[model samples]
Target: MFTRILIANRGEIAARVIGTARRLGIATVAVYSDADAGARHRDLADEAVHIGPAPVSESYLKGDRIIAAALATGAEAIHPGYGFLSENPEFVEAVEAAGLVFIGPSAASIRAMGLKDAAKALMSSVGVPVVPGYHGERQEAGFLAAEAARIGYPVLIKARAGGGGKGMRLVEAPADFAAALESAQREGRSSFGDPAVLVEKYVSTPRHIEVQVFGDRHGQLVHLWERDCSLQRRHQKVIEEAPAPGLPPEVRRAMTEAALRAARAVDYVNAGTVEFIADGSGPLRPDGFWFMEMNTRLQVEHPVTEAITGLDLVEWQLRVAAGERLPLAQAEIPLAGHAFEARLYAEDPARNFLPAPGPLLHVAFPDGARIDTGVGTGDRITAHYDPMIAKLTTHAATRAEALSRLRRALGQTHIAGTATNLGFLRALCEDPDFAAGRMDTGLIGRRQEALTRVPPPDDAAVLFAALAALDLDPARPFLGFRLWGSASRRVELVSGGTLVARDLRLLGPRHVAVEEGDRSTAFEAVAATPDGFRARHGGRNLHARVVRAGGAVSVLLDGRITDFSVIDPLAVEAAGGAAENRITAPMTGLVCAVPVTAGATVARGDILVVLEAMKMEHSLRAASDGTVEAVHCAVGDPVGDGTLLVEFTPAARRPDEAADG
Candidate 1:
């Protein structure tokens, strides 16, 4: 094995590679940009190298700079972790020219499967089942539209050089084809610098299943079963599992064999994934699966495969890069148990899953699970890269057990200072259809309302926050007693943008009554421990964990994390101010476009500006009918969160409305 290697990526994947390298006694070097100077991955490596600025183009995407760093640090090889330079054929060629081993497929192999259209053609030539589509090289808009018409309605326009759902659109009719194509091409150019796209038949009910395959320089190849990644939002996988449930035995065998054929056809080496979209109209069969695309590098969900197979895929990548033969025959690699992986991201599900980058005040993962993360408490989640916080995975002997464990693990995860999808993940795990394995790519879309609903703070959560804010000990006598008798204190909490005030009357040392409006509930604490408070309310006993960070308090109650901001009622009342009719950037990002100019009249819900951040586009809309007073930002200008982008003047009020007021 090579003694020293450089990881040519950032965040969790880089840290993940470092872990395996350390276990194998191989020294690892990590490269970082200006934004990731103090990143966890760099701190974990044996040595670190400063590349360039935070922008990926100047740092992570600069193949020559990365190669130079590797050579200067005496790294024997470079491991391009999933994204960025991982699938770039030119980068692979550059590394080879520098006489450093690239810990992945060769440049030729990557080129063969780099573009979706070309890869589809290659798969078809090799007898691999492929989705019917136009894989031609023509880029004219009219020709693409004609091809979509021939394919029938509800066709998909996918960028030839795209991944992670960027540069993809589904057109339901010919009328929308032109606009969708234009949008797709624009995103394609912005994201991949390639405007080429292909038209494909959109599967009405699709389940994403991919087979993990490995090959060595000695020409040995094998498949590591499959993972079902049907749970998706915005065309990105949210939850993934290994040993795909509800797949027929014959289908599994055929899929694995087909994957092996695809690998051999490209002369592929190292770790790669052959993705397939299966028809979910009925029971899964071998004939219902068709090739979608091949990811020419390690996948984000590879941990689920590792959990099921009891093998380290990163180690395999290193061994193959070192010219070692296949570690085991196909039959020797056993699939023992079912596993599930939930991608915990720092995003607000209610805000259409908008990326919310901020400091991680408190970060804690559950026990009995594997957490692969690149950030910790006190770390800032920068907008320069993906907003994925961690990948939590669990394995069990049965699918039911695995799902249950996954749900429990998600509930146990604690985070603060920024919004997260922990509640959404918990709801997904508890979904009946998901539990029964009736999942598809549209599952999240179909059940979005229920899955993203933010539950109100319960009484237990309010009480816990009150105790933490007041520094009151439930075990002590006369905790909230006045000179004459029990005291009544008003506690104010803010949750999910709604402010709630409750009156707490201390009846005794361990007893209190909480009054909210006309409703009141009495609770008696059995004991107060460092972990949580066990209390009885409404004839039921419950334990709620209290996590206090700064002025924010998060209570984990009944598998739901309810955050509360303990506020002073007097201060809140005194600080009230008139609303400023201004549209601000929701998060730090570059202003992509300003749709409205000064003095332009726009109705509520009209898009005023578009901001690009975290690899996604978000629009700032007018809050009310108003005229744009001034445009504060121009296209290509970088802005921070809450930075005013546009100022608007409210429309004139009617005479009757003014008289009433």
Candidate 2:
């Protein structure tokens, strides 16, 4: 094996590679941009080097700078994790030219699959199943539209050079084809610098499944079964599983064989994935699946596959790069129990899953399961990179057990300082269709409203927190040595938009009575920890981690940490509020275009503006019909959440309508 290797990537993948290298006794080098200077991966590697700025074009994509860093650190090979330069054929050639081994497929293999149209044609010629679509070289808009017409309605326009859904569009009718094509091309150009596109038949209910395969220098190859990546939002994977649930043994065998054939067709070596879009109307079949594309490097969900197979794919990459033959043959590799992986991202699901970036004040991950993370507490989730915090994976004897463990693990996690999709993920775990394995690409979107529903804290939990906060001061005894009956203290708590005022009468060290307005509720408290209280109300056990701050109490109940500005009842009765139609930016991104003009009339749900952030276009819409008063930002401007985009006044008939909040 090589003595030292350099990872030409960042984030969790870099940290993952460093971990494997350490176990194998291989020295590792990490490359970082200015944004990732204090990142966890930088400290994990044996040596680190600064590449360039935060933008990928100047930093991670600079293959020459990466190569120089590798050589300077005495790295014998470079591992391109999965993005940036991972699939860049030219970068592979450059690395090979510098006398350093590229720990992945050859440049020739990557070139063979660089463009979707070309790659589809190549796969078809080699007897592999290719989706029925337009794989021609013509790029004219009219020509592509005709191809879409030929393919039938509901055609997909995908960037020939795109991944991660950046340059993909689904058109339901001929009238929408032109607009979809323009959007796809623009995104493709901005993301990959190549706007070339290919039209394909859109599967009505798609289930994304992919086969993992690896090859050695001596031409020996084996397949590592498949992963079901059907859980998605905005065409990106949110959850994945190995030994796909409800998949049959026959289908598994066929997929493995087809994957090996595709790799052998290209004389492929190293680790790669062959993705497929399966029809979800029935169980997977040999003929029911069609090739999507090949990821020419290690995948983000490779951990699930590793857990099931009991093998280290990165170690295999190192062995193959060192001129070794295949370590295990197809027959020797075993498929064990089921595994599931959930990607925890710093995003707000309620805000249409917008990326939430900020300093991670406290990040606490579950202990039992394996967690692959690139950031820790004090790490800043920069907008210049993906906002993923970690990948939590669980493995067990069966799919049901794996999912149950996954739910428990997620519930045990604690994170603060930024919004996340944890609540949404928790809802998914309890979703009927998801738990029953009736999943498709559109599952999340179909149940979006219910899945993103916010639940308010129970009244009993709130009352316990109020009582606990009162005892935080040691000088104030349990009964306060009161001369009369128990001295009652009034406190106010707000959660999930519901405000409640509680009257706390401390009965004793383990008992209290709470009164909200004229109604009264009894609570029994047991001191679990000095900082938190365990309370029981109406037969349900609840935990309240109470922290005293600014004469108020912040209570963390049921994993949803909330702050309650506790104030004297007489001090807050004077405040009041009104309903308003306030416009706010959905996410931190550049204002790509403002469609509304000053004083223009826009109806409800009208497209007011478009913001581009994290390489995705989000259209800010008008919630009510009104006359536009102002636009707070211009095109090409950077804005954050709640950044005003436009203001509106009611129609002349209701000129005195209430303001928007």
Winning model by TM-score: 1
Candidate 1 regions with alpha-carbon error over 4 angstroms: 481-486, 568-581, 598-606, 622-630, 648-661
Error of 2 at 396 (Å): 0.9
Model 2 lDDT on a 0 to 1 scale: 0.83
Give the clashing residue pairs of candidate 1, or none.
Answer: none
| Candidate 2 off by > 4 Å | 460-486, 493-501, 528-531, 539-541, 544-582, 650-661
lDDT of each: 0.89, 0.83
Candidate 2 residue-wise lDDT, 302-355, digit = tens: 999999999999999889988999888888998999999999988877768888
Candidate 1 lands at a TM-score of 0.95
All predictions: root-mean-square deviation over Cα? Answer: 2.4, 3.4
TM-score of 2: 0.91
TM-score of each: 0.95, 0.91
Q: What is the lDDT, from 0 to 100, of the residue 481 in candidate 2?
A: 26
Query: What are the per-residue Cα lDDT tens digits for candidate 1 across 1-661?
Result: 9999999999999999999999999999999999999999999999999999999989999899889999999999999998899999999989999999999999999999989998988899988999988989999999999999898878989989999898888899899898789778877888899989999999999999999999999979999999999999878899999989999899999999999989999999999999999999899998999999999999999999999999999999999999999899988998998999999999999888889999898898889889999999989888989999999999999999998999999988888889999999999998999999999999999999999998778777888778877777777744554635648778777888788688887777688878888888888864577776778987888887887887788888888888888776457254454355777777899987788899898998888998889987677887678788899999899999889888887665434456888
